[model samples]
Target chain A: MQIFHRSTNTISRATIFGAVFVVAALFWVAATVQRSPYVTYAGVARPQPAPFSHQHHVAGLGIDCRYCHTSVETSSFAGIPPTKTCMNCHSQIWTNAAMLEPVRESYRSGKSLVWNRVNDLPDFVYFNHSIHINKGVGCNTCHGPVDRMPLMYNYASLQMEWCLDCHRAPEKYLRPREQVFNMRYQEPSSSQPVLVDGQPYTDQLSLGMDLVKKYKLRTATDIMSCSTCHR
Target chain B: MRNCRKISLLGALMLLLAGCRQDMHDQPRFKPLAESDFYADLRSARTPVEGTVARGQLHEDTYFYTGKIGNNPGDFMPFPVTEEVLARGRERFDIFCAPCHSRLGDGNGFVPSRGFPRKPPSYHSERLRKAPLGYFFDVISNGFGIMPDYASQIPARDRWCIIAYVRALQLSQNATMADVPSGEKVPSELPRFEEPGSGATLPVVEPKSANSAPEEPK
Candidate 1:
C-alpha cells in the first residue's frame, strides 16, 4: 500500500509537469500564427503584370501627370488610367509590344489592372492631392523625380515628420510654375536672366508664402493646426 | 492552492468588469446643436436671403450671347488683355485647357486623341466665333454643357487669362494683318488649327434671319 501511494504521487507530479509543457507549447504556436499580415516572405517579390515607365511618359514624352493619373489634382487616390485610355494609342501604336500585354489583356477581360501600390501610407492617415497642389506644392515636392522614374518608387519616407516639416514651413519649397516637375528644385541661375517671350520676368508671386501671408499665420504653432493635415 | 485562488479571483474580476455596462449610448438626451451664433444663423437662414453688398473687385458690365455670327450691341467689348496677363493665361491654358480644347481651340485635342467620346467645342465654329468674350469667360468660369466647372481649378484672374488666350486663339486663326498691332513683331507663321485626320469635317452652320434684327443693348 505504501509503494502504491508513492507511485500514485509520482504519476500525479509527472502529469502536472507534462500538462504545463503542453500548454506553453500551444501558447507559443498561437502567438506565432497570430502575427499580423499573413503574407509569406517571398510574396514581397511578386511581379507587376506590366512594366510602366513614368520617366518615358512624363519627362520624355512631356505627358502631364494629370493625363494618366486623372484624380491626383482632385481626390485622395491619384486614379490609375483605364484600359481604354491605354487602348486608344496602343491599339494603333504598339500592338506587338510585350510590355503593353497586360493593358491589352485588361481591355479584353473587362477587368481593371491590379497595379500594385508602391507608396502606401498607414490606413489612418488621410492625404489629399488637390489641396497640396493648389497651395503650390510641386509634384516633385512629395512624389520626388516622378518624371525621371522608370518604375515609380516612394521617394519620401512619407512619415508624419516628413509631412509635418513641409506643413510647418512651406516657403522654402515654393518655385516657379515652370519648375513644377524639375526635381532638383534649382532656382534660375544668376548668370542667365530668366526671360519669357523676350521680356525679363521675375517670379514675384511666391504662392506658399502668399498664402501664409494672406492667412496671417502668427506663429509656427498656428500653422501646424491639426485641421491643416488631419482633415 | 494560493495560485488557484489567485487565478479564480482574476477571472472573477475580469468577468465582473466586463458585465458592468453603462446605459450611456441608449439614454435619451437633449442638447444644443451648435456652439456658435454663426452656426445658428447658418442653420436658421432662409433661402433668397438678401444679397450681400458687393465687396472687393467690381465686375465690368458685359453680356454673353451664343448663336449667329455678327457684331450686335455691346459686341466686341474692349478688355485690357495685357501681355503679362496673356502670357499667364497661356501657361494656365496650356496646362489645363490644351488637353481637351487643343492648343488652337479646335475640338480635336489630346482627349480625343486618347479616345474620349465627347469632343470639346471648336473656337472656329460660328456659334463660338459670334459668342461674346464674356461667354467664353463664363464657360471657363462656370463650364458649358458636359464641361466641368474650371473655377475651382482656375482662379478669377486665371479665368480672365484663359479668356484672353481663347481670344488670341480665335484671332490667330481668323485675324488678318489689320488685327495685328502696328510696329509689333509678329510670328511669321501664325498658329492655325490642323484638321484632324480621323475627325469628320463638320459643316459650318448658317446664321438665322432673326439674328439680322436691330441689335439691342442689355
Candidate 2:
C-alpha cells in the first residue's frame, strides 16, 4: 500500500529542507554575534557590590589612578582598592550614607567586597600591567577614558587580535612618559609645531618611535611569538 | 514515526548546543588556600621552606633594606642621588605620597580636604625639613601612624628616591636667594599669591543643584 501521495511528499520535503536551512542560518548568526568580542566583552559592565563611579573619583575629585590601583606599576595585577582605601575617605565624608553601607560593612567585618571582574582574559594569556605601564603605554590606551566612565566597563576587546594590533604598531598608541597618567591628554596638533626649548618640532610619530627605542620595547616578532602570551 | 523524527531532530540540536560548553572554566585545580586531603597540613598552598630567598629579592644590604645603620636612622642615601634618580623619585612621589602629603608637601592634599583621618605633617615644616633622609625612608617603609607602609608597593631604592624628592620639596619651600645658582637666571617677579574670597582670582564654580546638594547639617 502506498503510504504517501507523490505530489505532497515533494512539497513537504522541500518545506522541511527550507525550514532546516532557515533555522541553521538563524543559529549561526546568533552564535557568531553572541561570541564576537565587540558584543561579548567590550562595553559590558558587570555588576559590582557597590555602585562605584570612576568619574566621580578620577574626574570630579581629580584623584590619580595610582591612588586606588596602588600596584598597577609594580605588580602584574592592578589591584582593586581595599576596604581601608574606601574608608580612608568614606568614613569621614559619607559616614552615614545608605549607598556606602557595603563599604562600611566591609570595613567593620574585615571582609572584602567581591567585585565582579570586568576585563577578564582567558587563563592562558599572560598580561603584565607593570610592563605595559612602564613602557609609556597610557592607562587610557587599554582602559579607555576611565575618568569619564560613571560605571567602569571593559573598553577594549580583550581578544588576541585586539592585543596584537597594539603590540604590532605601538607608536600610534604611545604617549609621552609624563602623559601616561593624564587620562585626558591629547596628541599635539600636527599642523602646529610645539616649541621645545626654543626649537620648533612637529614629529609626534618620530618621538613615539624614539620612545619605543628608549623604553626597549620588544619587536613585533618577539611579542607575537606563541610562548609570549600562552605560557 | 513522524513525531519521533521531530523529537530526534530537536535532541540533535540540543546536543550541538551542549557540545559548545567545554568545561574550561571548572578545571581540576586547587584554588589558593583551598583545603587539600593530599597534603598533611590540608592546605593547598605550601609554605616556603625555611630561608628560601625568592628570585631577585635578596635584600642583603642592611642599610639599603632597613634604612638604619646600627639601630640609628642613617643620614645619607644608600644610592647616589643623580638627576635621573631624582626624576624617578618625583614621579613615584607624585603617584604615591602626593595623595596624602600633597605635591607641595603642604599636607593639604585632595584627600585631606575630603576628610581623611588626619592631615599628614607638612614635609616643608621645620621639624620635617630637619628630619634625616632615613627617617623619611623609615616612615615610607614602615608606616607612621594611620598611614600604611608602602614597603610592598615601593622598592627600597624607590623609597630612598622619594626621600630625596621630599628633601628637594622642603628646600623649594625654604630656598633663599643664595641657594640659587649665580649663572642661572631666576624669575624676575615672584608669583602673586591670590587671597581667598578674591572673585577675580577664583574660577566660577556653578552652585550644586538642590538634588545634588549635600545633606543639611544635623
Candidate 3:
C-alpha cells in the first residue's frame, strides 16, 4: 500500500520540500537567463546569404556606413544596398570566388539575397533610423562597434527598458555631428573641454546639454511617452 | 495515490503555462504588395486615385523637379550654389556617388575596382567637364546606361548640390597656378617625407617567401 516502507533513515519531508523548491528556483533562473538579450541576441551572429565582413569593409577599407545602408539619413529604414552595389566591387575584385557565388546569382537572377535580420525589434515598435541619425545619436551608441564586427549581430537589448534608458536621457549618448559615424569616437574626459565653434564647453555632459538645446530635442517626458514609439 | 496526483497536477500546470504565449507577432495585416481580393485591381496597395496629389508633394517648379527646360536639359542650377550647398553636395556625393564615381571623381571607386561591369566616366574627362549642370541632374534623375536613377534616394536640392560639387571637383583637378587665390600660396610640390621628429621607426618586416635570405635589421 505504501510506495516504500518509511524508515528512520528515509529522507525527511522538510528536505524533500527544500530540494523541490531549489530545483524549481534553479529552473526559473536558467529560463530567465536564457531569455535575457545578452544571452539570446547580443554577440549571436545570424547567418547571411553572403558572409559580409563589416570589419573588412568598414574598418579595413574605410567605407562609410551610408555607402551600404544608403537611406540611413533619409528614410525610416536604413536601406540595404542592392545587388548592383555589391557588383560595383565584387564583379572585379574576387570575380571567381566560391564565397561570392550567392551574390553573383542574386545579381544575375535579379532576386535579392535574404539577409537575416540581426537587430530585430518586435513588429509593434516604430523605430526611425533617420530621426535618430540626424538628431546626433551616433551609430555606435546602439550598434556597439559595428566597424569591428566580422559578422553583424544584435548589439543592444532592444528591450523597452533599454530604449527608455536612452530616450529618458539622450544627452549621455549624443556625439558631435561629424563623429556620429566615427566608430572609434571616444567620449571626452570630464576635465577636457570640447570646443564647439571656438567656444570651449567643459566635459561631455555640458556639450551634450548644449547640443540638445541647439538641436531642439524634446525633453525626456515627451520622448518617453507611449505614443512616441508605439504608434 | 497522493504522489501520483501531485506529479500529474504539476505537469498539467507546466503545460498550461507553455500554452499562454501572447501572439503579437501573428497579427492580421496586409503585407507589402500582397494580393487582396477586397480591391478590384487584386492588389493590397491601392494606386493613387487618378490625379490625386498628396499634401506637400505639389511639385510646382518644373525645372527643379525635371532638370529640363522644355525638351533640353537646363544649363543652370535651380538655386544659387553656396558654400553650404557645396558642403551638402559633397556629403551626399560621398555617400551615394563616391561608391562608383569615387571621392576624387576619378571613376576608380572601391566598387568598380573590385569587379563592377563598367567603371563610370571620370568627371575630369573633357566631355563630362563640358557637360551642363542640368545634364548631370538629368542623368541622376533618369539613370544613364546601367546606373539606376537616384531621384527617389536624392531630393532635387541635393541633386543640384551634387552637380555643384562635381563642378568644383572638375575645377580642382584642372586648376592652373593662376586659379589659386592671391593671398594663398600653392605648395610647389606635395610634401612626401614624414617629419624628422616623428620618432616612429618603420618595423622591419621579413619577406614572405620561404627561400629568401633574412637581411640584417637597419
Candidate 4:
C-alpha cells in the first residue's frame, strides 16, 4: 500500500468526480449530434437524379401540390408522380435540355429513375399523409417553405422527439383545410385574419384550438400514446 | 482465477456491444417505392399483373368510368352535382386542366405560353359548348389530339367533376344580363391584388366584359 504516494489518493478521488462530468458531457454530445443535420439530414439538400426546383414548378407556375402528388388525400403515402407525369410536360417543353435527360431516359427505358428520398423516416415510425392532410395540416406546416426551395430537403429532424412535439400540441399548428396545400399560407394576424367555418380569427392560438375541436383531432393522450406511431 | 474471471467479464461486455446492429431501423420490408436488390428492375413496388384487376376495383359503373351510354358520350353526370361536387371539380380542374385550358377555359394557361404547340380548345367555343359532358370525360380518359390521356393522374370521379366545372365556366362566359338573378349587383367588388402576374403567383383577374369574346391565342 505504501508503494504509491499519498497524492495518488487525491488523484483517484478527482478522477471519480471527473468521470461523472465526462459521462454527462458524452450524453449531451450524443443528443446534440442525434438532432444535428449530420444524423437527421435535416435542412440538407440532397442530390437527386435531376435538380428539380419546386420554386419553378409550384411558385412560378402556380401548380397545386395535388398536381404531382395525386394520392395525398386518399393514401398513407403521398404518391410520387410517375415518370409519365414528368413526361406530360417535358415531352412538349424543354425536350432537349441536358438537365432533363434522366427524366427522358427514364421515360424511354421504362426503368425507374431513382430519386433520392428527401424526407425519409425510420422503418419503425408509421406516418399517414392523408389523415394529417384531412385534419387540416398545411403542407408547408411540416415541409417548410417548399415553394422557395430550389432543391428539396427535409425541414424537420424527423425524430421521435420532433414527432411528439406536434403530437402533444397539434393545436398550435392547425390551419384551415382549404389552406392546407397553399405554400404561401400565413399564420393569422391582425392584418391577415384567417376564416375557419365562416368565423374570422386574427390570432393563431384561438383558430388552432377551435380547429382542434372542429377537425375532431384525437385527444393529446391518445395521440401521444406509444402505439400511435409505433406498433 | 481472478484474471480468468476479469477476462470473462470483458468478453460479456464485448458481446453486448456486438448486439447493437441496425436491423430494426432498416427492417427487411419494403416501403412505397423502396429499392430492391432481388428484383432485376430494383423496384420494390410491382405493377399489377397483366390483365388482372384488383378486387373491389371492378369499376362496374360504365357511365361513371367511361361516361359513355352506347358507344357515344353521355350528356349527364353519373352522380348528383352539388356545390361540394362543383368545388371539388373546380379544384381538380385548376390543378389538371387549367395548366393548358386556363382558369377561364380560354386556352391561355401558362403551359401553352411556354411553347406547348397545341393550345387547348376554349370551352366557350360554340362546338365545345354544344359537346356532351361525356365527350370531355372521354377525351380526358383517352388522349385527344396532342393532349395525353390523364386517366393515370386523375381518378374517374375527379374527371367528371372537371367536366361539371367546365360546363359552369362555359355558362359564365356566355351569360346574358337577363341571366343575373333579381337583386345582386352586376359587378360586385373585384378582388384587388398587390401586384400583377408575377411568375410566382396568380394575379386577381377582373371579370371579362360581356362584349369581349374568348380571344384566340395568336
Candidate 5:
C-alpha cells in the first residue's frame, strides 16, 4: 500500500464519494427513462392502416362510443368495430373516396382489416371494461380526451402504479353511469352541480362518495389487493 | 490481461441475460382479437364451427329471437316494459338506431343528413306508428331496405327494448295531454336522470320545483 503516494488516498476517497453520486444519478436516469414517452409510448400515436380520427367520428359526427364498440357494456373486451360498422355509413356517404379503399376492400374480400392496437396492456392485467362501466367509471377517466384525439394514442402510462392510483381511491374519479360514455362530461362544480337521483352535488368528492355507495363499489382495500388486477 | 478477460466475460453474461428478457409480460396465450401466425387467417378469435351452438345460445323462445309468430310479425313485447327497461331502451336506441333514424325517430339523423342515400322512414308517420311491436323488431333483426341487419350487434332483449322506446316515441309525437292518466303528471320525471345514491335520503324534485325555474328570454 505504501508503494502509492499519499495523494492516492485522497484520489481514492474522492472516487468513492463520486461513485455514490454516480450510482444515484444512474438510478435517477433509469427511472426517468422508464417513465418517458420513449419507453411507455404514452403520448405517442401509433401508426394504423388508416388514419381514422376519433375527433371526427366522436366529436364531429356525434357518434356514440357504443355505436362501434358494441360489447363494451357486456364484455371484458371492448369489441372492435367490424368492417361492417365502417360500411354502415361509408357504404353510402364516402363510397368512392380513396382513403376508404381499405375498408371497401375488406368488405368486398370478406377479410378483416387489421387495425393496430393503441392501448394494449400486458397479459397479466385482467382489466374488465364492463365492470368499470357498470361501476360508473367514465371512459375518459382512463382513455382521456378521446373526443379531442385526431388519431388515437394512449393518454396515460399503462403502468401498475398508474392503475393503483385509481384502485386506491376510485371515488376520486367516479362519475354517473350515464356520463360514462360522454367524453365531454365535466366534474361536479358549484356552477354546474351534478344531479344524482335528483340530489345535486356541488363537489366531486360528495358526488363520487355517493356514487361509490350507490354503485356498491368494493372497498379500496379489496380492489387494491394484488389479485384484483393480476388475476 | 486475465482481469480484462474476466470483465469481458461478465459483460457477455449480462448481455445474454438482457437478450433473454422476453418472458412474463406477454404469455403464450392470445389476447382478444390478437393476430395469430399459427392460423392462416391471422385471427386469434375464431368463429364457432358451422352447425355448432354454444351453451345458453339455443334461443328457445322463438318469438323473442325472431319477433314473429308463424311468419307474420307479432304484436307484443317478450317482457313487460318498466321505467328501467325504457331507460335502457332509450340508451341503446340512441347508440344503435339514432344514426339514421334520429333520436326523435324523425328520419333526420346525422347519417341521413350526410347523404345516406335512403332516409329512414319516420316512426311517427301513420304507417310506422301503427306498425306492431314485432314488425319493428323484425326490421331490426333482419335488415330493412338500405339498412343493414343489427342482429349480430344488439342482443335479442335489447331489440325488444328498442322497440318499446320506439313505440314510446311514436306515442309522444301524436299524444295529447288527455292521454296522461288523471292525477299523474304530464311530462313525468325521468327516473333515469335522478342523481346516483342509495336513493333513500331524498325524494325526487316536485313538479312545482321544476316549473319554478327562471323562464327563457322571449
Candidate 6:
C-alpha cells in the first residue's frame, strides 16, 4: 500500500510539470508567430499611397520645393498637394501615364487619396513647421538628401534626442542658409561660389545668419519645447 | 501546510479575478438643474460646490510666447529679407524645391522622365518673376492655381524660406556666370530641358488632342 501511494504521488507531480512545460512552449510559439518579417512599424515604413520622389522633383526639375510642398513656412505638414493640385499638371501633361494611375483613380472615383503617413509624430508631440523654417531650419537638415532619393524615405530618425541635440547647439547643424540644401556641406575644401535662382548665395546666407541672432533662437528647444511641439 | 498554501493561492486568484471584472458604473451621478441661473442658485437648490473657473477664453499657453512665428508686425518687425533669412531660405529651397524644378529652376523633374504629365513652370516666367511678396506669401500659405494650401504642412517661416529660395531660383535662371560670385563655380550640369529618364523606358508620346501638332506656320 505504501509503495502504491508513493507511485501515485510521483505521477501527479509529473502531470503538473508536463502541463506547465506545454503552456510555456505554446506561449513562446505564439509570441514568435505574432512578429512578422514585413512589419517595419518602428521606423518610417508605412506604405505610401503613391511613390513620391524628392530626387526627381528637386534635383531634376529645378522646381522650387515650395511649388508642390507649400506648408514649409506657415504650417506643420509641408502639405502634400491635393488631388486637384495633381490634376493641375496631370490634366494637360501626363494625360495618360501609369505612374499617374493613383491620381487618376482618385480623380475618377471622387475619393480622397488616403496617403499613409511616413514621418508621423506621436500624438502628444506638437511640431510646427512655421517656427523652424522661420528660425532657419532647412527642410533638408532633417529630411537628408531628398534630391537624391527616388522614393521618399525618412532619412533622419527624428527621435526626440536627435532633435534635442541640434536644439542644444544649433550652430553645429546651422550653417549659412545657402548650405541648407547643399548636401555635401562637409566635402568642399575651399570657398565655393553660392548661387540662387542664378544669383549669388551671399545675400541668402547673410540673411539666415542675421535672423539667427535676431530671434535669439539658440537651441531647437528654445524654439521647440514640450508644449511647443506637444500641444 | 499544503491546504494553507492552496487557500492562499485561491484567495489571490479570487482577488485578481475580482479586479479584472469590467466596471461601467464608475462615474459620479448628478441631477440636472431646472433653471438657467444654476450658478447663483446652486447653493440654495443643491450641494454647494467649492470652486469654479471661468470658461470660453483662448487657452493662453506656451505657444503664445515660444510658438510665435513669422514676421510679427507689431513688436520688432525686422525685415526677414535679411541675408541670414535668405540663406536659410536657400537651404530649404534646395531640399524642397530642386526636386520638381531643376537646379536651373526649369520645371523638369523625374515625373517627366517617368512620362507623368505636367511640365513644371520655368522660373523665367515673367508673371512669377514679378509676383508680389504678399502674392508669393499667399501662394505659399494657401496654394494658388495648381498649387495646394501649405498652411497645415509648412510653418510660416519655412514658407518664407521657400520664398527666399524662389528668388534664388529666379536669379539662377536669368543670371550669367559673371553674375555668380567669384568663388562660386557655375553648376556643371545645366538643367535638362528634356525629362531625364524618359527617352528609352517610357511608351511613345501620343497626341492628346485630335490635331496634336500645331498647324505648320503657313
Model 1 Cα lDDT, one tens digit per residue, B157-188: 67677777887888789988888888876774
> Model 6 over residues B13-115: C-alpha lDDT tens digits?
9997896553422222221222233454322125434464347333343222222235421222224578767766765555444445554567764445455
Q: Interface RMSD for candidate number 6? A: 19.1
Give per-residue CA lDDT, model 4, range B8-67, as digits (tens): 999999997786677888899999988999999999999899989999779889999999
TM-score of each: 0.48, 0.75, 0.75, 0.89, 0.88, 0.45
On lDDT, the leading prediction is: 4
Q: Chain A of model 3, TM-score against the native?
A: 0.85
- Give me the runs in candidate 1 sitting further than 4 Å from their true place: A1-47, A176-185, A192-211, A214-219, B1-167, B188-218
Q: TM-score of candidate 6 restricted to chain B?
A: 0.47
For candidate 4, the per-residue lDDT at A160 reads 89
Compute the lDDT of residue B142 as modeled in candidate 5.
Answer: 86
Candidate 4 lDDT, tens digit per residue, A1-231?
599999999999999999999999999998898789998899999999999999789877877788899999999999888999988888999999999999999999999989999998888988999999999998988898888899999999988888888899998899888778867667888765665544667899899999999999999999999998998
Docking class of 3: incorrect
Cα lDDT tens digits for candidate 5, B93-160: 88889877877999988777876767888989999988889998989988988888898889999999
Worst 10 residues of 5 chain A by lDDT: A191-200
The list of candidate 2 runs beyond 4 A from truth reads: A1-32, A35-41, A87-96, A191-210, B1-4, B25-60, B188-218
B1-218, model 2: which lDDT tens digit per residue? 99999999999999988967736633456543344679864556576788898788788898999889888899898888898798888777877787667778898876667666578888877788888887888888888787777776678888988889888888888989899989866764333322332111212122234244322110
* Candidate 6 ranges beyond 4 A from true positions: A1-44, A178-215, A218-225, B1-218
Counting clashing residue pairs in each candidate, in order, gives 0, 0, 8, 0, 6, 78
Recovered fraction of real interface contacts per model: 0.00, 0.16, 0.15, 0.42, 0.30, 0.10
Question: Roughly what TM-score does model 4 have, to 2 decimal places?
Answer: 0.89
**lDDT on C-alpha atoms for all candidate structures:** 0.58, 0.74, 0.76, 0.85, 0.84, 0.55
For residues A14-42, what per-residue lDDT tens digits would candidate 2 score against the true structure?
A: 99989999999999998788657556568
Instruction: Provide interface RMSD per model, one decimal.
Output: 18.1, 15.1, 15.9, 9.0, 10.0, 19.1
TM-score of 6: 0.45
| Per-residue lDDT of candidate 3, residues A149-228 (tens digit) | 99998888777878998899989888667657767666766443344544555578877888898788999899999999
What tens digits encode model 5's per-residue C-alpha lDDT throughout A1-231?
579999999999999999999999999998998898887899899888778998888777778888899889989999999999898788789789898899999999988899989898888889899999999998989999988899999999998899999899999999988778877677988766666765667798988899999999999999999999988
